[model samples]
Target: MNANKTLAIGCILGALAVMTGAFASHGLKAHLSSYALSIIHTGVQYQFWHALALVGLGSAMLRFPSRRLGRASLLMIIGTIFFSGSLYGLAITGMKWLGPVTPIGGVLLILGWFTAAWSFWRPDTDSVKA
Candidate 1:
């Protein structure tokens, strides 16, 4: 993911996360079961966090550009889609099939963090601050 693209995606995801959270709390409260609402809430939280992480990754690239950082951002985006997306689907549709995807997303998220750590250890020095 290019830095600009990562930032753009992250911003959009963040906005959507807020939208979904509000809907879950107010609009969906009466319509959805408590269990379902809670699941969506969790999804919103993770989505928001990862969205911010993408934003951060993009910003950091301005000073410490690296392909690894891009990879990290990509993984976070994928993780957000699968992890939060699956929960949203399951909660909204009561579909058990999406449950299995959650762990895969979780794994992707973990890999993202590891890739981020690698980014720090080996940033593009030309881009880094002295």
Candidate 2:
């Protein structure tokens, strides 16, 4: 995706992270089990961090456009959807099947970070020298 889109997604996800965190603590506190709350909290943490990462990636892309960074942003967005989305679904709906998807998301998140680093380590023709 483009830098502008990445920035938009990052901002939206960041907002969602904050809202989710607040909802979990206030609205769901008494309604959810501690384990469920913990799951949501974990999701919020990962989502928040990745959201920030995407923002950084977007900002960097504005300065130095790179396909690798775009790929990293995509991975992060999809991974957050899978990881945090599954956690939210599992916690709220008690769906056990969602548990298996979390690891895939985690792997994607790891790959995104590594890819981002690699993108910086070896700048492409489109990217500025690091």
Candidate 3:
């Protein structure tokens, strides 16, 4: 995907994450028990961090446009959905099965970071070295 598209998606995800956090804090605080609230908090925390990662990925794409970076960003996006989304669903709906999916998402996040690191370590072929 292009830098502009990546940036746009990042912005949307960031906005939604903030909205979800706010809802969890203000709307669901009283309704949810302490354990559920903690789960929701975990989801919000991961989503917020990944949202920032998305912005960084978008910036990297604009500057470098490496395939590795693109893959990393996509992985981050998927991880955010699976990790945070599942936690949010499980917290609100109390479905135990969704817990297993969270680890897979966490693994994707680790892979995404590794891919991003590899992208940064490679020389920028588009740039003229002095």
TM-score of every candidate = 0.93, 0.94, 0.91
Model 2 vs. true fold: TM: 0.94
lDDT of 3: 0.85
RMSD of 3: 3.1
Model 1 clash pairs are none
Candidate 2 lDDT over residue span 21-58, tens digit each? 99999999999999999999999999999999999999
Candidate 1 differs from the real structure by a C-alpha RMSD in angstroms, to one decimal, of 2.6
Model 3, position 119, has a per-residue lDDT of 80
Error of model 2, residue 79, in angstroms = 0.4
Candidate whose lDDT is highest: 2
Clashes of 1: 0
Evaluation by TM-score, superior candidate among 1 and 3: 1
The 10 consecutive residues of candidate 2 with the worst lDDT sum are: 121-130
Would you list the clashing residue pairs of candidate 3?
A: none
**Ranking of candidates on lDDT, top first:** 2, 1, 3
Per-residue CA lDDT of candidate 3, range 56-120, in tens? 88897877777777788889889989999999999999999999999999999999999888888
RMSD of each: 2.6, 2.2, 3.1
- Shift of residue 114 alpha carbon in model 3, Å: 0.4
